[model samples]
Target: MRKFFDPNLAGANLKDRLLACLGALLGIGLTSVISAAFVHPHGAFLLIAAPMGAAAVLVFAVPASPLAQPWPVIGGNTVSALVGVAVRMLVPAPELAAPLAVGAAILVMSLTRSLHPPAGAVALTAIVSGPAVLDAGFAFVLIPIGVNSVILTLCGVLFHRFSGHSYPHRVAGIAPAPINAALQAEDLDKALADLGETLDVSREDLDLLFGRVEYHARHRRKGSTGGFPTGRAA
Candidate 1:
């Protein structure tokens, strides 16, 4: 229980952790306040969806993640909300609609390349929310869900400039052949194809990580204390 409950996140220091917390607060707080400003009947409409909380975690804590980028954050949540609202309206049976809504949302998110994890919750929220959501119909996709997603993602973009890591970081890409290559760019592509699943990390970032690990391993075995490796070179 203790092991399971303890922080499993690696490589994050106190400052990093605190910044993530602060970013979450700012992103969600502002999303709620800003979204509420224009939309009326505030009681009927939620200022922001609950899934935005999870989105805040990704956008701030793992800003480099492909899923945390602006397109995914906005498209995933908004499309999933559309899916959820559609499912709720079409299917009267709550039990069947719940699973189908989530599954269809996943399918759409995958095809769109907007597979954010919190999108699952956004889809579910549509199924479970009151008549106000269903009554809002397609408009629900734009007003609250879309608006909230845009604001929260924007906050993430602005906040990370000060958080020591770049936001909307590079997506996976092919690296040139190294002088002495153990891993090739094609190898990463083939491996991902064989895995048949999307990883939260970008291929570019994964390439960098593997290159660093290989550099350290080689140097450690040679027992040389040289300057830290910068990055992989062709």
Candidate 2:
């Protein structure tokens, strides 16, 4: 029974956790209100997409995640919604359409390099959002899905900046070389393939993380002991 629990629970401190909660409150609230103002006719589920709530968890709490980035948040939700709307229209059976929409969403998000997990919810929501969403047709994709994603992303960016955390946390910069010889890029690639499941983080990011960890470990050892030897070269 204990094995069923998630081991990797979020380890954020109280301050960071509170910041994420506040950000979610502001982001979702603004997104719902602003979106509904524009699409007042069927504003309930149509304007205020349910998936954005899941998105808030990613954007605010897990700011470092690749899935939380702007492109993934926006593109993933919008395209998945498109797939959902298309599947709903083409397939008359709700049972078939629901699963098909989710599956197609994974495929499309993979090809687009925008695989945000909340997008799965977006696809499923689009299918079961009732006649109002169905009647909106393709326009639904742009109005609610696209509009909501953009607003939420914007909120994340602004809030994170204000809270002194990087919003689009994925940054390009010169990084130190990896000192750990055992963990190569090729090895990570093979491990990813063997897992046969999509990992939320990129291989490059993992590499960088490992490299930084190795560098800091070495630095700490050198500082602690004057005669400490260097680590083996990779």
Whose TM-score is greatest here? 1
lDDT of 1 at 130: 79
* Clash pairs for candidate 1: 172-204
What's the distance in Å from true for residue 126, model 2?
A: 1.8
Candidate 1 residue runs with Cα over 4 Å from true position: 1-6, 40-45, 171-179, 193-197, 227-229
lDDT of 2 by residue, 51-85 (tens): 88999999998888889999999999999999999
Candidate 2's TM-score: 0.82
Residues 1-234 of candidate 1: C-alpha lDDT, one tens digit per residue: 556544456665667768999999999999988987757363445767788899999998888878889999999999999999999999988899999999999999999999999999999998988777777788778878899999998898899888878888853323444423676778878988999997777777777777767768878988987755534542
Could you tell me every candidate's TM-score relative to the true structure? 0.87, 0.82
- lDDT (Cα, 0-100) at 35 in candidate 2: 88
